[model samples]
Each structure stands twice: as structure tokens, then as C-alpha cells.
Target: MAHLLHIDSSPRGDRSHSRRLTREFVEAWQQTHPADTVTYRDVGRQPVPHVDEPWIVAAYAPPEQRTPELWEAIRVSDQLIDELIAADILVIGLPMYNFSVPSTFKAYLDQIVRVGRTFAIDPEDAEDPYKPLLLGKKMFVITARGSSGFGPGERYGHMNHQDPYLRVAFGFIGITDITFVHVENDEHSSESLAASIAAAQAQVAQLVAA
Candidate 1:
């Protein structure tokens, strides 16, 4: 059975479009693949601590040379990386904040993208020093935005840092097989929101079935 790591980074809970869409996606996926297991994390509601100086040292230090204190500093990082490595598929709910991801999700990224764990940084090879370790994993990101026209060549496309940032960030860790399902116009009129939701639902169904 496939394993899924389901993460929701929306503070709005029930009112969050990304949250609802991700739930629907996972539910539909479960119905199709009943034996699949899911691990859930809500970083938006219960935020994780940001990386500190000690965390920085712990991440770059050699595993064999790390002291007990250094290990303690990266305990959460270790756990998060372990969970990430264990998952075959990742379904993340992302709500755009100021044209980017929430701080909570950023913190999660900082924790999981470890130097030696998720990737290897080699100063010797300046051309391709960073080698990603989390390979053969598929990612599906459901992004909710207040405004529309964030697609490529659109009016506000250049300002659309959310998905592009995500792609690069996750791609750096070897998860390049990523798909995005966007629900736009969240802060617009009721009709617009409903239409966005309906379109998102159809996309979710197709993605789950595929």
C-alpha cells in the first residue's frame, strides 16, 4: 500500500479552501486506494519552532562528531525528515499569504531540508554541490489564493512566487514530480468563490482518479 503524508498549512481551518480541497482529495484517494495509509500534520494551527543557531550547527555537523546537545537541537529535524522519507506521496494544502507560503510552512521547510539528511552539500563540487536524497517521491500541492491571474504570462504572473517557489524548494530535495491544483479568487465575490471551488473539485477528482 502507498503511504501519504498529508499536510495542511491553513490557519482558517474550516473556512480554508486549500484545507477543504486537500481533505476531499485524500478522501477520494482513500476510496480508490483503500489500503493506503496517511500521516497528517497541521503546521498552520500548531506551528513548529524556527531553526536556531544550535540547529544550524547540528545540521551541518558530521553525524559521527555531533555531541549530545547538538543531537538534541536537531531532534525535531530528524523526526520531520524521517516522516518525509517514509512517505511515497505528499499532499500539501498551501494557502498563499502575501504572495507566498505562510511562515509556519516555511518553518516546516527549514526543519525538513537538512544538509546531510535530505540533501548533501559538497563544497568540493561547485557546479553541482547539493545532491538531493529524497528521491522517487510524488508531490501534490493545493494552493489557495485570494486573487486570480497568477498563471504564466498572466498580468500578475511575475508576482506569483507561491508555486514557483514551492517547485524550486521541493525540487532541490529531489521531488520534481510535483502537481499543483490552485483555487483562486478566494477574496472575491461569492459567485467567483463558488466557481473556483467547483473547478477545484473537478480537478481534485481527476487527479485522484489518475
Candidate 2:
């Protein structure tokens, strides 16, 4: 059975659409794959710290050359990377904060996307240097937005950075098989919100069944 990693990045508790959708998705997933295991991380509530000088220094240093102080600096990063590598499937609840990911989620990303852990640098290839270490993983993202029309060819599609940024970031780490389920228009209309929710739920159900 496949192991799943579920992470929520919305600060809101009960009022978060992405959070609710992720919970629903996980529940449905468990019903279908009872033998599978899940690991949960609430990055929104218990946000990880942003990368600093010490973290950068430790990350670039070789494992053998790193002192205890350096190792300690990257301890949380090591743990986060371990969880990412262990999971075969990932489900993330993401809320769009000013057209991008929340700072908390961004911090988590900075921690996990390490050089030797998540990716490797290749000096031989001048055109492409970064080699992805994590492979054979699938990811599902549930995104919530205050406004609508972020899809391709839409009015605000050019302004949409959340989905594209996520795709590129995760794909950089070898998670090319990523799908997004979006719930939008919570600020303007309730009917639109409900419709989006329904569509997202249906997509989640279909994905879980498959």
C-alpha cells in the first residue's frame, strides 16, 4: 500500500476552503485504501522557520565536514526532507496569499528543497545542473482563492502565480505527476464558491478512487 503525506498551509481553522477540501480528500482516500498509511503536518499552525545564514551554510557544507553546530542548524530541514522522501503520494492544502503561497509554506519549501537531499548539483552539464533526487511520487494540491478566473486564457490568468509556481517547484524535485483542484470566488459570491467546492470534491473523489 502507498503511504500518503498530507499537509495543510492555511492559517484559518474551520473557515479555510482548502483545509476542508484536503480533509475531505484524505477521508475519502482512507476509505478506499484502508491499508495505506498517512502522515500529517500542519505547517500553517506550527509554521517552520525561514532559512537563515546558518541554515544556508549548513546546507551547502558536506556532511563529513559539517560540525555539530552546522548539523543542528539544519535539523528541521533533515526531518522535513525525510518525510517528503518517505511519501509516495502527497496532498497539500494551499491558500493563495497575495497571488503566491503563504510565508509558512514557503519556509517549509525552503527547508525541504535542499541541495544534497532533494536535488544534486551537476557541474558537467552547463545547460542543466540540478538533478532531482526524489522520484516516483504523485501530488495533489487543493488551492483556495478569494477571486475567480485564474485558469488559462482567463482575465487574471497572467496574474496567477500559485499553481504555476507550485508546479515548477515540485517538478524541480521530480514530482512531475502533480494535479491541482482549485476553489475560487469566496469573496464575491457564495454560489460560485459552492460550485467550485462541488467540482473540487468530485475531482478528489475520482482521484482517490483511481
Candidate 3:
């Protein structure tokens, strides 16, 4: 059975749309795939440490050349990477803040996106030096936004950074098969928010069945 990694990055507890949707998605997923296993991470409540100078040094250095101190510096990074590598599917509850991901989620991304682990550089191939290591994985992002119009050619499309940034970051590690479900209009009228939530929940249901 497939293994799923469920991650929630919304600081708001029960009030967060993203968190609620992700929980619903996972519960539905488990119902269908009874044998499947799930691993959960809550970066919003317990944020991962941001990468520091020692982390940089440790990441860049070859495994054989790294000292005990260097290994210690990247211990948490290694654990995060291990969890990512072990999972076949990922479901992230992301809330947009100022048109981008929250700082805590960004920190989680920084911890897992590592060279020689998630990706590699090949000096021999000048045309394609960057190589993605993680493969055969799927990702589902449940994003909650304050307002709508983040789609392409929409009113605020030009100001949207969340989707593109996540695509590039996750694609860099070979997770190109990604799907996004958005719950928008949080700051708008209750009816608008309700409609968005209904659409998002429908999409989530479809995805789980697929």
C-alpha cells in the first residue's frame, strides 16, 4: 500500500481552512485505502529550524569529508529528507500569507531541499548539471488564500508567487506530478467563502478517489 506524508503549515488550529481540508482529505484517503500508512508533520505548531552557516557547510561538503560537527549541524535536515524520501505521496496544508507561503513552511522547505540528497549537480554534463533524486512521488497542496483571483490571467495573477515558487522548489526534486486545491475568498463575504470551500472539498474528494 502507498505511504502518505501529511503536513500542515497553517498556524490557525480548527479555524484554518487549509488544515481542515487536509484533515478531511487524509481521513477520506484512509477510508478508501485501508492498508495505506500515513506520517504526519505539523510545521506550523513546531516549526523546523532554518538553515544556518554550519548547515550550508555540511550540505555542500561531501559525506566522506564532513566532520562530526558538520553532521550534527544537519541532523534535522537529514531526518526531514529521510521522511520525504520514504513517502510515496505528500499532502501539504498551506496557507498563503502576503501572496506566499508562511515563514514556518518556508523553513520546512529549506530543511528538506538539500543538494546531494534531494538533488545533485553533475559536472560532466554541462547541458543538464542539475539532477533530481526523488522520483515516483505525487503531491497534493491544499492552499487557503485571503482572496480569489490567483489563477493565470486573473485579476491578481501577476501578484501570485505561491504556486510558481512551490512548483519550482518541488519540481527541483523531481516531484513534477503535483496537484493544487485552493480555498479562496477568506476575507470576502460568507457566501463567497462557503462556495470556495465547497469547490475545494469537491476537488479533494475527486483526488482521493483517483
Candidate 4:
């Protein structure tokens, strides 16, 4: 049975489309894989601490060479990394804020992407210095945008950084099998919002079954 990590970054409770879709995806996944386990983390409600100066020092320092104070500084990062490494499947709920992911989610990302833990750096090897430790993982992102037409070759495609940023960050840690289900037109008409929600629900159903 696979271990799934469900993370919601939307600040809005009932009004968030990404939040609703992620819940639906997890519920459907549970129905199909009843024996699988899930771990839920709501970064919007309970945000993780951003990395500070001490955190930076602790992260780069070798574990064997770290002092008690240094270890304490990076305790949370270690725990977050451990949880990420344990999960085989990840379901993330993200709403576009200022054309990108929420700051709370970005803080969580900074905490988990640690050196010598999630990734490794080998300056000696010129060909590939940065190595990804997390592999064979799958990610499903439920994204909500205020406007529509952000797909490839669209007018606002170049302006859209939400999905692309997620892809780059997650791909940096070796998670290339990522799928996005977008619920757009939130700032538009009610009918459009409903249609987008319906389409997202259909996509979630198909993905869970697959």
C-alpha cells in the first residue's frame, strides 16, 4: 500500500476550489485503495516557519559536525524532509495568489528542500553536481486561478507562473510525474466557476481511478 501526503495551502475554507478538489481526490483515492495510509498537513491554517539564518547554517553543516544548538535549529526541517521522503504519492492543493503559490506553501517548500537530505551537491562532478534523492514519486496538484486561458499558447500563458514554478521546484527533487487539475475563472461569472469545478471533478475522478 502506498503512503499519500495530502497538503492544502489555500487560506479560504469553503470558497477554495483547490481545497474542494483535493478533498475529492483524496476521498476517491481512499475508496480505490482502502488499505493505503494518508498524512494531511494544512499549511494555510498552520503555516510552517520560514528558514532563518540559523536554519541556513544548520542545513549546510554536516550532521556529524553539528552542535546541539545547530541540530535544534534544523529539527523541523529534518522532520518535514522525513515525511516527504516517506510518501510515495503527494496531493497538493494550491490557489494562485499574486500569480504564484501562497507564501505559506513557499515557506514549507523552503523548509523541506534541504541539502544532504532531499538533494545532494557534488561540486567535484562538473557534469551533474546537484543530485536528486527523491525518485519514483507521483504528485497531483489541484490549482485554482482567478482568471482563465493560461494554458499553452494562450494569451496569459507567459504570465502564468503557478504550475511552472511548482514543476521546477518539485522536479528539482526528482518528482517529474506531476499532474495538474486547474479550476479557473474564479473571478468570472458564476456559471463559468461551476463549469470549471465540474471539469476539475471529472479530472480528479479519472486520475484517482488511474
User: Best candidate, lDDT-wise?
Assistant: 3
Better of 1 and 3 by TM-score: 3
lDDT, model 2, position 82: 95
CA lDDT of every candidate:
0.94, 0.94, 0.96, 0.93
Itemize residue pairs with steric clashes in candidate 4: none
Which ranges of candidate 2 are over 4 A from the true structure?
none
TM-scores, all models, native as reference? 0.98, 0.98, 0.99, 0.98
Q: What tens digits encode model 3's per-residue C-alpha lDDT throughout 24-137? A: 999999999999999999999999999999999999999999999999999999999999999999999999999999999999999998999999999999999999999999
Q: Which ten residues in a row have the lowest lDDT in candidate 3?
A: 157-166
Instruction: List the pairs of residues colliding in candidate 2.
Output: none
User: How well is each residue in 1-210 modelled by candidate 1, as lDDT tens digits?
Assistant: 999999999999799999999999999999999999999989999888899999999888889989999999999889888899999999999998998999999999999988878888889998999999999999999999999999999989999889999999999999999999999998899899889989999999999999
Better of 1 and 4 by lDDT: 1
- Model 2 lDDT tens row, 89-158: 9999999999999999999999999999999999999999999999999999999999989988999999
Sorting all predicted structures by lDDT, with the top scorer first, yields: 3, 2, 1, 4
The residue ranges of model 1 lying beyond 4 angstroms of the native Cα positions read none
Q: How much is 39 displaced in model 1, in angstroms?
A: 0.3
RMSD each, Å? 0.9, 0.7, 0.7, 0.8
Report residue 83 deviation for candidate 3 (angstroms).
Answer: 0.3
Candidate 1 versus the native: TM-score?
0.98
